[model samples]
Target chain A: MRFDVTILGSSSATPIYNRNPTAQALNINERFYLIDCGEGTQQQMLRYDIKSSRIDYIFISHLHGDHYLGLVGLLSSLNLNGRKKPITLFGPAHLKDIIQMHFEYSETTIQFDLEFRATDPSKSEIILDNQDITVETILLDHRIACTGFLFRQKRRLRKIIKERVEELQVPVEYYAVLKRGVDYFATNGQVYPNNELTTAAEEPRAYAYCSDTLYNESYFEQIAGVNLLYHEATFAHDMLDRANETHHTTALQAGEIAKITGAKKLLIGHFSARYKTLTDLLDEARSVFPETELAIEGKTFVIES
Target chain B: MRFDVTILGSSSATPIYNRNPTAQALNINERFYLIDCGEGTQQQMLRYDIKSSRIDYIFISHLHGDHYLGLVGLLSSLNLNGRKKPITLFGPAHLKDIIQMHFEYSETTIQFDLEFRATDPSKSEIILDNQDITVETILLDHRIACTGFLFRQKRRLRKIIKERVEELQVPVEYYAVLKRGVDYFATNGQVYPNNELTTAAEEPRAYAYCSDTLYNESYFEQIAGVNLLYHEATFAHDMLDRANETHHTTALQAGEIAKITGAKKLLIGHFSARYKTLTDLLDEARSVFPETELAIEGKTFVIES
Candidate 1:
């Protein structure tokens, strides 16, 4: 399972100091899913070689301009470049109206099918279920309605050890049965136990993306034990009052969230424009959680099984 | 008087090959007027050190996504940066609705006074009249209701020759009258002619910005004898048929327009994505008009006085 994420933009409300607004690309099994496209997402996508046509799913966190302003331009470019495949968009209900108004004012009828699925921000539910994974929405506490996404990969069946199978002289036709945890029968009327010949598959890899919200423990258990966690640390720990007033989390709180959720690895981004150097913020997060890293733009972070 | 136009983006329809879509900044006497903000205009402004707070005037040519998609994002950024100065926006009437919808969905009240003046694409009208210059709409032929802009500089007072004034024993009080094209009267019963004492001021400079449009002679007379003319050359001469179908102008046609309009200099841009190096397009346009230049991004062209 090739599960990795690339940070597109790392700024919070304003894109300053060479930092862009919030946006990211999650590649799951060679499929790209855009998360929270900001104003310059299309250019960033081009900069990072993330093909817009390859993105079949887009998840918008909320209605803030920094989160979804680049959507219309990306869609227009996709149409201009002659995108034939359908693209599904998941966001709040008002986002659909915004898209419609842009198309209406521009006097353009979209050439591709743009399916809109409204995400429920008030409760947690399974929004997407496919053969590879099940995506569930995690309710978030924010100034506006927002939701985080938990991508849980499906567990695969047991794997057969190739050396053991060859040593036992197992027939090629019985390889499938061996992987299904069945005992292999030998020509000498002896049985080879499946547990001795095969090994259990690696644990399913999972990733959680938490966009923007204040510190809250309500949805922590749903994302517990995630292999990789991305959380927004819009401000430093000293600005906790300001973060509380604006319904945003601080770097200290982001680390606390990772600690409470038992996230194996933590990536913190969405830094406020007030600070040019993020050394203090990173140290604040690392003070509590050891496996913490800054979500630098255009850097890819992989999830290990 | 200082007047120059800087190209921010030059690509047409799509932003590719490290080229951006349509956008430019006109500096008139130190005041910045943003013209046709494309998708990444805000970032471009930031890259080139064009402060958003200094942009009090914005002119959007049409409602096409490539032409005005960056307007909302720019406005939001200005607001976020605590812009107390008011701004005047001129574009198609529906553009106001788009801005309103974006603000409404974001649940934000604009801190500055955003005044939107609708442009009438059917006829030529003076939309802005200030002491420095006058901006008029030039009706264009396009699929949508599109209009170009004609910036005409107001004539300044005559300049007095310091040596001539001193030699003629002209009184300091008579300097103002002499600049008004009147002869200076000496207390000793001598008269100094205005032409000999003060030479006529330099010719008022004018610039014409022709956005996406097909070749037409209807608005040529209005932009006649412009000091600098910026026209869209979306495709090469070989794509004439396609240009006509799309209501866009070719490089040859743009050169022809500049020649017939008696423009002092021509700057051709808005190149199609098919073109990587614009040498061929530049040569094609230069074949017809000798004083032709490419609207290279981040370069400023001064209008000679």
Candidate 2:
């Protein structure tokens, strides 16, 4: 399974010349989950050649224009392109109303099934549970009701040793049971240990996305030990006061959170437009967490567990 | 006087890869007037090396997100860049409310003066008149309340013959009167005719922008005989029915409007995302009006009167 995170946009509330606003894609196994669609997200997806049909769900952090202004346009484009599959969207209660009003005023009737789930940003909860993955939301501190998402891939079943299964004369019908760590029994009631016939399953990978939030240690407990963590670094250390005033996290603060959470790697982005060059931000973050990397647009970072 | 029209963005409603939404700059003498600030219009201005300080006025066609989503962001950037001059904005009535709400929520206090004037999309009237130019609104047909703009440079003053003025021994202060088409007289009651020392001024130029409008001939009277006319062509002739159904226009329809308006030249843009090549659109428009040309991004077309 290829588990990775792609940075679709890395800017903060404002739009800049080259940097885009907040958006990313988490690919778990073969499915893709979009996070925080900014103003030009659909065009970014097209520029990066990401197949929009592969997106199964979208997780929005808040109702800020920079965070999710592109949703209606993306949905309209999907309808224009003849998309029929159902897409699940998780966000605040008012998002559906906003999108509905835009479409209603424009008289644009979408052709896809959009299943919306209102997420309470005050508590941690499991928002989605599928066969291959599970998605949980952790509350974050922001001006508005905001939540970060943690996507954890489900553990795969152990594979049975083909030679051992053949020697044991296991029927093809019993393969499912064998893969589930169960031993195949003979008609004479002879016992075979399950651990001896099957190899252990691979370790599940996990990714956490913390968007547009202030430095809050409470979220560390929920996203601790994640293979990859993406946190918004809207300012550098010099603007710590501004970050606190605006309810945003500085690069150093994001790195400190990564350090406290013991995350495998830290990806810092959502840069403010004030800083044209991110060298100072990267240096400041790396001083706190050695494994921290700046989130560049259109680049994919693998999550290894 | 430097008079030309520079295309900042040529794309339509939905932004495509590398192609931005509708935005253009009309340079009349030293003043630059912007038209239709779509998403990333400020970045487009920066990319095309347009001086932000030189831009004195902005005319937005409608409230559609693609037409004016970038205005707030552009204003924020202008404040960040330390612009102190006042900027006048002309758009629909609701736009002021939208911009105010965004700025209030973001807590961004601008440093420069932002003068906003609401345009009535149902009428054709002169909205702005300055020392060197006059801006008028042309009612357009769209899904929303939309209007285009006509920028006409003020007629230039006649040139004075410096040698003739010196020979007549006119006072230095009287040179201003001479430039204003007034004859200068000596204290001895000597008569000097205005035509003897002055040459006729060049004819002023006019450029009309008809953005996101359907094939409506009612606007021909308002935009008739413009030196340059830019009309939206969202589709080719094959999709003429779709264009009409969506309240848009085809390339042939844009050319037809240009021909009806008796424009010196026509520039067609606002291409649909389905078109990867614009050769066919150019050919189709030229078949109707031979002076038609496709609007290419970052390309400047002179408005020859």
Candidate 3:
């Protein structure tokens, strides 16, 4: 299974220092999920060679311009490109109103079905579920109503030993049952043990995205033990006071959250436009969590299971 | 008088081949007026070194995403940067609803007063009047309610011949009145003629911005004899049928309009994304009107007298 995330943009509210606003692309087994599309996100996707047509789900963390302003433009282009397949959008209820008002003024009816599922910011609950993965919303503390997302891949089925199954003359229909940890019984009452023909699969892995939020522990348990955790570090340790005032998190606070949550790795981004150089911010994060990495735009990070 | 236009974006509906969507920045006597702010406009303004803070007014020809989607983002940034001076926006009446809806969702109170002046699409009217110029709306023929803008520089105040005014020992209190082209009478019964004290200022120049509209004869007389004309040429002559179907103008038709209107210079843009190179479109326009020039991004065109 391919589980990786590409940072399309990492700048906070303002686009400066050649860094765009907050946007990311998550690929789970070839299913593309766009998260928090900011301004210029379509151009960034084009620059990074990410096919916008493949994105089936879009997750918006908040209603801030930097988080969801590119949505309408992207949707317009998708319609222009003759996209017929329906796409699901997860965000606050008001986001649908904003998108609809523009289309109404333009007098354009979208050719594809645009389904909006509102996310609740007051509680953590399952928002999406499929055969491959399940997504849950993590209530966040921000100036505006915001929520994070947690993606957890389902555990893989047991691997079948082809030679053992063939040698035992197991029927093709029994293969699926064997993989489910059941013994195969022959017509003559000869049994093929499941343990001898199968091996355990890799454990389920999870990824979490938390952005534009203050340091709060209410939803920390929901994202505990994630393989990868992406958190916004809008400022460094020196600007902790400013971060608190603005309902943002510092690099040190992000690192501490990752460590306390037992995340395997930490990805920090949503950098403020004030810092032209990010070395000190990265170093500050690494001081607390050595597994920290900067979520640089156009770079992809894989989740290992 | 610093009457020049900077092409911030020029590509039609979709931004492709490194070409951006439609956006323009017009500078009239150091007062910047942004016209048709598309996506990535602020970034384009930053790339071209155009100061956003200097933009006092914004004009939108229509509600298509390519023409006005960037307005809210730009307004938000202005508020974030602590802009206090009021800025007026001239567009359709519903444009105000679209802008206000987004701000409401984000729960942001714009620090600056945002004034919306609705433009009437049924007839021509002066939408904006100031000391330097008067802006008139040109009722356009398009699929939607759209209007072009005609900027006429108010006739400049008569220049005071510096040496003549000093030689006559004209009192400072009479300078403003003298520039109004009136004869000055001295207490010693001396008469100072206005012609001897001032030379005729250059004739007032006009610039017309016609975009996202079909070639129509109704507004031709309104923009007759303009110094510079910017018209949308969305397609080449070969694609005239497509242009007509989409209610857009082809390069050949744009040139014909400019020639019939007697514009001194023609600037053609709003190119279709299908053409990676714009030479053929430029050549097509130049074939009919030799004064045609491509409205290249980041390039400034002077509306000279």
Best by DockQ: 1
What DockQ, between 0 and 1, does each candidate earn? Answer: 0.67, 0.38, 0.65
Task: Report how closely model 1 matches the true complex, as a DockQ value.
Answer: 0.67
Off by over 4 Å in 2: B51-55, B76-86, B96-115, B188-190
| Candidate closest to the true structure, highest lDDT | 3
- lDDT by residue (A156-272, candidate 2, tens digit) is 999888998898888889889878988768878987888878898889988899987889888889898998899989999889899999799999998899999999999999999
Q: Model 2, A26: alpha-carbon shift in Å?
A: 1.8
| lDDT tens digits by residue: candidate 3, A101-170 | 9999999899999999999888889999998899999888999999999999998888899898898788
What's the best-to-worst order under lDDT? Answer: 3, 1, 2
Residue-by-residue lDDT tens digits, candidate 1, A59-156: 99999988999999899889989998999899999999999999998888889999999998778999888777888898989988999899988887
Residue A231, candidate 2: alpha-carbon lDDT = 91
How much is the lDDT of residue A138 in candidate 2? 81
* Per-residue lDDT value at A85 in model 2: 92
Per prediction, fnat is 0.54, 0.21, 0.50
The lDDT for every candidate, in the order shown, is: 0.91, 0.85, 0.92
Cα deviation at A130, candidate 1, in Å, is 1.3
Report lDDT (Cα) of residue B269, candidate 3. Answer: 96
Docking class of 3: medium
Q: Candidate 1: which stretches are off by over 4 Å?
A: A162-191, B162-174
